[model samples]
Target: MRILQKYLKGGISSHRYKQYIICSLLALFMVGGVCGEYFTNCSSLQPGQYLCTEVNIDPRTQQPRGCTKEGWAKVLCTSAPGIICTETNNGTFEREIPCKYTNGYSYETALLLSVFLGMFGVDRIYLGYYAVGLAKFCTLGFLFLGQLIDIILIATQTVGPADGSHYVISYYGAGIEVIRMDNMTYRMPQEDWGVVGRGIKEL
Candidate 1:
């Protein structure tokens, strides 16, 4: 308010006043962009979708302490007791049974980078492949052939982060569905041991 009053009172030059307005507008735009991205990426999780809120090591026991939407929950689909808890690259436990995890890597960002700056290997570098990124940069994406291949791979999600982490994508976006295996889903052979042995001998 004081700065604006000073500018209005002719204490500041008109040119400098215009510069201040432009800078303030630019700052506001940048802040808005950041907030929009945060809402879209971090806070848009759907109901029943688990997000790993935090993970840490217990000082006394040295055991991994993982907290998800369920609060200190380590396993998903506990009634089925199928998928066990697994640690992700981002120091969080994999909260979903199908192994959906986000290591701060965005599928859209990767695809866009591959489509636009792939020749410069920006996508590869962003995916954590420094060596391959350097090679692609030096060879100009292998004369653009590698770039094409990478674009397709990233589009289909065949290639992901170099640390073996999955990309963060929209909930309804393209993804691989893995069926969970549990006691009900799997059973031991019902055949008698003697009969199986006889059959094996005949074979």
Candidate 2:
């Protein structure tokens, strides 16, 4: 009974730690102006280098007309009338990311994808479980029973990426601080893998 109690306590502690870590990261991102959700639209475009789309608003008709520029530019437009330029992140070009950060496989994303693709083992494969993922794929998510179990595990953060690295969700062209444990020690499962982007420079 004591052993079980200790195990439960450890598990709770670990979960809380991870939750706290995520919260702290979000807070830091917000304070540093590197928050990703805020950068999705034109209004929240950070004042840095970006590939902008030239948007011209007709003052008389209030209609928008513009063309995508083929190059990067410094955004200097506010919410004014007439012609204005907006930053584009259409994935065609790589612009400077103001504050690049890393994010793990979000519970919400995993949950949503699990509903549609879990039965076919696509979600497991996405999370990097190769052998078991292949098994589930072959067995149709173990005839759906395995999918149910995986859904629960993912929701509870019990099953993490098989590579032990978190997913990089908010990546700028530059480097930022990597995620660390509560003790300020790096938790990278492997070298040159856990941090965000192709070549992560730890800060």
Candidate 3:
């Protein structure tokens, strides 16, 4: 009975630690000024598809004219002159992303990677914090200062450098395939043997 009790207690402790780790990561992402729910999370466009039509609105007649991906053009709005509906993610251009997030990068992996690498500022570097990342690594994590801050920020979901004004990536691979939202046109993904492009189902 004593042995069983000890085993149960250990299991409980492990579970608690797991939860704590998850909470910490989300916190860091939030602090990074990259907390976006609309564009970041699963893309709004479908895979293997592209917008073919363009929409235009008539201010005088209070009508909308637009085109669809099927090469069929139509009005911008029906009766609602002030409202217009146009495709947000046209899925015309492809994007390139690291093959790790959904495939393997999990809460546990993130925790371990950020902690050990923060000492060398490796995580920051991935986010394009080249100078800071280099400085932190050189300072040995600011004598552990950098590591501590990284932990807190990471826990609070605040460890990002912003993906820019366009293509907000809010969620992982969920609603849409490998999302690639960008205001400007982008070339098709053809790196590492055409693994990345238009939309990746699982690559």
Candidate 4:
């Protein structure tokens, strides 16, 4: 009887700890996920925040060598030909925005994903949107009126349906894949959908 009681008590303790284990896991995920989003959101050093906006600072003066004040502006970005704006405030540091320029995927793939896998909301998930994925799944697409917004969003990088920071769809996924806008090929990876080595031109 004593031995059986000891085993029973240990099992009970384990069961009690199981709930704590689950709760700890949930807490860790919440903290890690929140920290990830907060740091990444404010990390953007881009100026003007729009493709049409002019550089917030004068490039020559933007650096400490010349003028651009710390609170004033950090970097000069002209949605001009290149993707340059980087650095927060008037600091001398900057990092180029990835996927800001064309990277790779394809209009056709996004169209196909929307047309075929849309009902599953896999299309939105593939676009790096989890909440949208849940929402579309919930309405059974009775909310497809949202499709109009989606279409325009897939049409151009500039057309942000939701907060761009929320949807970091990898270049290898949906969105524009090597778009040949205005005779000039975009600066995106020249590969087919998710294919490995073959370049679009060679293939």
The C-alpha lDDT values of all candidates are 0.66, 0.54, 0.47, 0.47
How do the predictions measure up, each by TM-score? 0.43, 0.32, 0.30, 0.28
Q: Name the candidate that leads on TM-score.
A: 1
* Selected candidate, larger lDDT, 1 vs 2: 1
Residue range with the least summed lDDT across 10 consecutive positions in model 4 = 60-69
Model 3 quality (TM-score):
0.30
Is 2 or 3 the stronger prediction by lDDT? Answer: 2
Q: What is candidate 4's lDDT per residue for 74-177, written digit by digit as tens? A: 33333322222343322223323332312233345655676666655666776667788778778755467666556656656543323232223443355443
Which has the better TM-score: candidate 2, or candidate 3?
2
Model 1 lDDT tens row, 84-149? 233332212334322344566888899999999999999999999989889999999999999999
The per-prediction CA RMSD against the true structure, in angstroms, equals 27.7, 26.9, 30.5, 24.6
List candidate 1 stretches off by more than 4 Å.
1-98, 178-203
Task: Please give, for residues 125-181, the per-residue lDDT of candidate 2 as tens digits.
Answer: 777777788898899989999999998877655676675543332222121234447
Candidate with maximal lDDT: 1
Where in model 2 is the C-alpha error above 4 Å? 1-104, 167-203
Candidate 1 residue-wise lDDT at 144: 100
In candidate 2, list every pair of residues with a backbone clash: none
- The parts of candidate 4 lying over 4 Å away from their true place are 1-105, 158-203
Model 2 accuracy (lDDT, Cα) = 0.54
